[model samples]
Target: MLASHEHYRAAVAQLNSYAHAYYVLDDPIASDEEYDILYHELKAYEHAHPDHIAPDSPTQRVGGSVLESFEKHTHLQRMWSLDDVFDIAELEEWVARIHKSYPNAHFTCSPKFDGASLNLCYENGVLVSAATRGDGIIGEEVLHNAKTIASIPLTIPHKSTIEIRGEVVIPKEDFARLNAARTKQNLPLFANPRNAAAGSLRQLDSSITAERRLLFVPWGLGFVREALSQSFYESMRAIERFGFYAPKILEAQSTQEIHAYYEQIQQERENFSMMLDGMVVMVDDFALQERLGWTIKSPRFACAYKFPAVEKITKILSITNQVGRTGVITPVAELEPVEIEGATISRASLYNYTDIEKKDIRIGDCVIIIRSGDVIPKIIKPIESRRDGSQTPIAPPTHCPECGCALVQEEVILRCCNLSCKARIVESIIYFASKRALNIDGLGEKIITQLYEEGKIASIIDLYALSVEDLLELEGFKDKKAANLITAIAATKHIALWRFINALGITHIGEWASKELDRRFGLACFAKSYEEIIGIVGFGQEMAESFVEFSAVNHELISRLLALIEPLPTGSAVGSNMDSAMDSSGGDFASSAKRPLENLTFVITGTLSVPRDDMRERLENLGARVSGSVSKKTDYVLCGSDAGSKEQKARELGVKIITELDLEKLIGF
Candidate 1:
């Protein structure tokens, strides 16, 4: 056996060599598999011989590796942030300033990733470590976990140690898969995939990193070895030549082109393999990039053009049925709306059966479909009723179409007949790939549905049976795309086991709950038997029983399914408050003069129309809270638009019905 000192030195050499290949040369020597062996060995040695572990080891680059509890890491570089400008006018002002500074300045544009930024270090291109831009400098180390991502090459070709930066993301479709998985497991929802990915990467254990199937795209340039002489676009080209997956950069010939490009990309957002928040504009010239220099946070040379939310109108042709991972039957409205957003709009979500009942949406209804631009299009409401069969109620499916099992209804959701129902197999695969669940890349709704329909796949376990050739044969699947999808599936084996647990679409479980289980017991230990897990802090009888039941019935199935996933390391401990970790911005907003509501709830009605959401978030930040519907606890109802029932409800509850102006006065805004 090698001595601890030898092991330490060996690990350093291995990591450093990896960095060299990945950064300086853009070529790689060691495969990730080879590097992983060395790293794991080094980690094992360090655990056994902590004293021998060198401080400057590549492993030291990250912050939260193996930490049972995290001590706050103060950033070496203050995490100064960028000031945001949402619209074109602000973007124009920014450009004008640059033009004013150096007349004859033009711009170049790159696609903005809608994912989280990360600082990466490579000791010779074998990715040695990764950290979030937590506070700016010091961040949780997730080397073991990051290695699982296929796009993040383990070693570079030329071989020289380097630290690089990139964004960690889940593609838009993958975000949908994750959310679907979460829905099946009854997990709390994530607003978008960007939020989901950010949360996933921040987990302490690198093992959890493996399961997230995060894809890193080199966007902003961080550390460069040789003197660079190229345009911003050329520089990015240089970066890509170095073997990184550069962000998709498109040219905008005119303002219309720029808008069109943005719109085009936004329309295809769902079709992409990675998520993007906005598009970045830059000068293609290297000298121009240098001339632009850096702002406190963002570089002055580039500007991000944010896409507006897509909105459109469609007639509700009919309500459609969709089986979820947990077998919940969802009602979707097939539309005939002229596509206003980038892509065609043929469908919109009606949410659950309760929503259907509430909206009283019927077939052939003239409903307005809203896409919010980039995200999924959803049904707003029907324009009263045109020809009404009195707003036909969609009957819930009573049995699994793919398997003979009686459907069950609870909480207003129509669920499949059996937990392992054949119909649920496609749904499960979709859930497994959703943005909130396992976050598998390239696995989309139509694709998963097709796989099941073709009788080539069933159950989440069936995903493992797929070969690249299988994918290649499918429509629109290309060589690179097929490879990427296969790689993504292979990489998922190593994801945080809790993500797997959460992806199973269990009852009474969510990301938060899965995390709770991970915190209380490691995935391996927790999965052994439900009885042992029940003893955990919050594992009540109901939750405990459910956990046990799922395990008992699905143990073999989950085991086989897990075998298909690549084994990723678990996250280390961090300074996280389990309940509050979602987004730990402290305290709600309230004006000093008004005295913050401190969790006080209020309602809104009518249309004074500052856009209700705008007012709501503003109030929330001010410490005053707002709820959608009126309730007894509502202190005030800010009235706007067509105020009818809500206004009456406010009066009946003896609650104050205030105008938008009144709300403005109260907040002193």
Candidate 2:
């Protein structure tokens, strides 16, 4: 007879599986938390049965896998990342700069999304597409799943063209249920709701994609023909008009008031369903945004003040290990799943043995796990209170988990067999075919995992050897997908030399390295001459040394890789202005332009009726950027009544001090 505890175990298993279908898959097969009660019951059983263990346990796997690749797509606008402010001082400094610019600069503070960043596209006010923040310029489209989000309205009131940008996130309770199901199914679980939603949104199939209950909150508009409001709140109401969930805005009159708003958000962390990573403070006026302008990346006007992450102390139940794409062995702590920042965190990465030693963490010892800002939970410290003699030190692995190859300990890292490890074969294949690299359209990580699990394809070299029969048998793949994968791989055979260089995933070389190489050498010569690279601009001793190390490390593979990508084209022949930037001196533009304010340095001090940043920008547009602190080089100080240090400094330096009115006259208003 099955024990009463076994009944609870079975119930828990059913609940978690259904939860996965509903939460992870976004296909709700059962009522919400129908599985939760079962999960709770199973936990009760586990508390009773410390001896009985389930191997295919949802309780086991760490959620979220780093995909080998993402398919590339053009962003409607672009998914620009927000510039960060570390502290309140930076925020205040930003406010002060604004005060100098626009006299009537009243600002609003909004809860900065603590979820996945996205760029959403709509045509005729109908939701059409969504993409991840891959780079600022390009992202992968996952519109099918994004459409299922009720909060992300399918149609808007506007008849004219419109597009918006926002984030997609999984709510906390839903995240827990999905994880419980994965635990029961013994499938790998998600690390957090944010990452989980991101992974789900990227799925290729519309049906598979629709399963994650993602919420899209339109933070700001993208490409809209007409202005919604004169200010930021009006824009929200406008987006709301189009049937999208607009974020709550906290309008503040002063910088002090803005700080008060952020403090309130911090105090109300758990009050909201979607997590609040930080506070995004911005001036409301559209004219002001135009006046302030932008940096190359972000708008000059806004800032995200990230909240101090919710942290809690928990016991390190035990230690475990996981093999990564490179076959590097990493230590992970199995913590007693504790609540912090609206989610239950059971695991934290120990990076390597170096990390293990640095923290001096031990099994059965108490440790503090911190979830700060946008999280990948980190270990803060050991509690020392729970240090019992029952704790044991975990030794680093001697062999690769998958291939059984001997492992080696580098200075701070642990490595398995260099070229031949199975972990690497899968990872390299994935990287070799990623969006920025070769971009094999149908080649998802799930497929690669299956191929690796089934022993159908072994190495990236083996990917060339894959036949029609090799891909057809994988679950969800069909005749068309197999053919498409094959065609994509064939097309990838003739790709950019920079893409080839980048696909190799060298230790420190990134997109920048490959791009730099493209500027110096075209594809054909690049493959042959990359080894000769040393002492170029930005190419330093360490980069060259790593290249030399890599040559020795992957000699045979590199040779094969060269053979595949050699005849392919290089990227654009446009030599980077960086290649020989000294060849032309455009510094003469500032010196050449007979500016009205050429030699004059203006330091704006004290509050004006307008934000100083706006005032500064206008002065700059007329060709005079404001100086922050007063110095001997300063030509004038724009003083307000409370002007303290800067006014005093200007006086000591014998500098001309101007009022806001005088300052405007100098800029030739």
Candidate 3:
């Protein structure tokens, strides 16, 4: 035991050193294989003796507990913003003003990272707390998530408490990878690296943040108990010694030097791994900064020279209408090709007819378009001064462009009510085989389009009828490719119930709602009424109505699908006699043994050992029905940490309240 303890200590020290070397120093002392072995060893030892785990252990980065909400933390020193100067003239003017006070003052210029601002507070050389720069004075505590960043040192060399300020940024490559993954999951793409970084840093689940690979680049100090250095540049350099990636900075003696550096960064911005929107120029002398003090919202000693907005002027070639999987008509402006931020901006989403009217966009008119990484290009406005009288105004389409069906207007969107619209059908088939749905690996939009145009497939049901011979008739299908596609389609015949439901392309029924429906009803959802479905947690009237309407209208199609495929019980039916319990037509059969909580209803609230969705699935698997709200009919409220109004409502109604351990006991653990 003594030897094990000593080994654990040694492992922790070695792993931390290795991490510092790799993440901060950019010099790896150990190979990945060596690191992984030692990491697993430490993890196994800590798992066996959890009480003996050290706080600074490398394995302690991500906490097991998920937070319900972030608590507000007051900053020891206010986090101030830098004043902005857009052009060289504005920058020179600011420099001239600064020269009036300190004629020979030196300045430090660093890239202004486009990301979320973070303030990390360390106490007695040990990392303690970290937060966002909320309102400069107070912020939300995110220490648990911050610890997951390998570059952030768990312990610094400084013994006294100090606050280190930095920006949490995702590299351009990482941001692109993240968006690509999100695209596969049918999730919304983040606008840019800045938004992605901010969203990642603020996740309640630290594990999600850890997966984002956020980097913290230290720029300056905040609340220091003891002074590190008198010079601002020297102090930042000193902070680098404590295991942090130092901010990229250049010392400047004049406005020309500062402008020269700014121009260099702007010209070579594409070569950088992370996003930079501007350059921050600060007085290098600590005494000068103190004397200059601050304005109401920003430091007077520092100013930001922002890069010009990433916008380009392009002529609108034509307007095109596209029908999405949901039959919504989106207006797209095809523009004369122009480059902005190294990406070709040939087309921009005009959103709808209302947006076109508001922007007064017209064909043949020159317009300004802006784009962020991974986000679709958008039209800013028409360049009215350059608009020629020959330009024609854009008008909303009276009918569906694909099927000539009369359109229905809803709020700001126009939609074709025809379910058989060719464009809609083609898109729906693509979505049904998407990664988040049935996930037929080789099936893509181009393949589906080719198949559809060839009259080999008209509907998703027709996919089951496809043969290798029929596929071989298409342009590029060799025997192997054709066989693989047929096999891939056949493999999806026995997918989870939730995945099958999502693949149906039902309106208002996304992946989450599909899982909820699967957990509660399984196959029985086919027979459930609107009241029954709306009673479940997070199921609104629109969703319940959509499900019911889709089920009713596509009864024959669904029946045919069921005849061809078998949806295995998911979430709540992974085990037990589910195969015998329910049939294709949503019929229930008698089981040999009574399931636990066979007739009970539960309402769950707050953070738990697992996510609330997982907890609900477990309860449902034991024959309990989970509801969204606490009613008099609720048998119990499974409460975890930070349980909110639902727990109180349960108490008011005299429903039983239980913890995770209590739940385990009930499950006969």
Model 1 residue 2 distance off true place after TM-score fit, in angstroms: 21
- Candidate 2 local lDDT, 1-669, one digit each (tens): 225866756764575466445444447787656655655666666667767645323332212333334567677565555678867788878888888877679887888876777777666665566777786667776665565555555556675666677878878777788788889999998877777877777765555445556677667766667666788878887776654566678788787898888888888877877767888887788788779976656877787888876678888877777778776788889889998765678888988988787877788878878887757789877766677688777677877676676666556887653555656777777787786566677786778778888998777777777887888877767898889888777666555555577777765565545544544554533333344676445565555555555556566777776676452433333222221222132332222343476435678877677666555544443345366778877788888765667887888889998897886576465
- Which residue runs of candidate 2 sit more than 4 Å off their true CA positions? 1-73, 315-318, 354-366, 382-412, 431-447, 460-669
Model 3 C-alpha lDDT per residue in residues 1-669, reported as the tens digit of each score:
225898999988899989888876668999999999999988889889999998789987864557867999999998998888989999999999999978999899998888899999999888899999997888999998999998888888899999999999988888889999999999998867888999988888888988877889988889998999988888888888887987678999999999999999999888888888889999999888999888656988999898877778899999999998788899999989998774567888989999899889899999988764334477899998996698999999989999897776666788774546777788888988997677787998879989999999998889999999999999989999999999999877667777788888877787657766876788878668999999987677878877876676566777778778778655444332333322322322112143566657888987798867656655655667678899998899999886777988888999999998998788676
Model 1: per-residue lDDT, tens digit, 1-669? 346586678777777668556533447888889777777777778888888776445555443354333334333233334445467677767767876777666556666776777766655555666667775646766555566555566555534545566788876666777878889999997766677888777665655555565677776545556534455566667667765776667654345556667777768766666655577776666577676676545666666677665555567667667776676777777777475533466777788878877877777777777655255677777787455564565665666555655555556676663546765666667777886676677787867887778776866776777888887777768899889987777666556655677788777665545654654566574355666777665456666666665666566776676566633323433221321222223432221233454446678665555655556545654555466778887888877765767888888989988876786677565
> Which candidate would rank higher by lDDT, 2 or 3?
3
Better of 1 and 3 by TM-score: 3
Query: What is the full ranking by TM-score, best candidate first?
Result: 2, 3, 1
Instruction: Give per-residue lDDT, candidate 2, residue 289.
Output: 79
Local distance difference test scores for all models:
0.64, 0.68, 0.83
Listed in order, each prediction's TM-score against the native is: 0.39, 0.61, 0.55
Residue 291 displacement (Å), model 2: 2.0
Model 2 TM-score on a 0 to 1 scale: 0.61
Candidate closest to the true structure, highest TM-score: 2
At residue 173, what lDDT does model 3 achieve?
Answer: 88
Which is the leading candidate under lDDT?
3
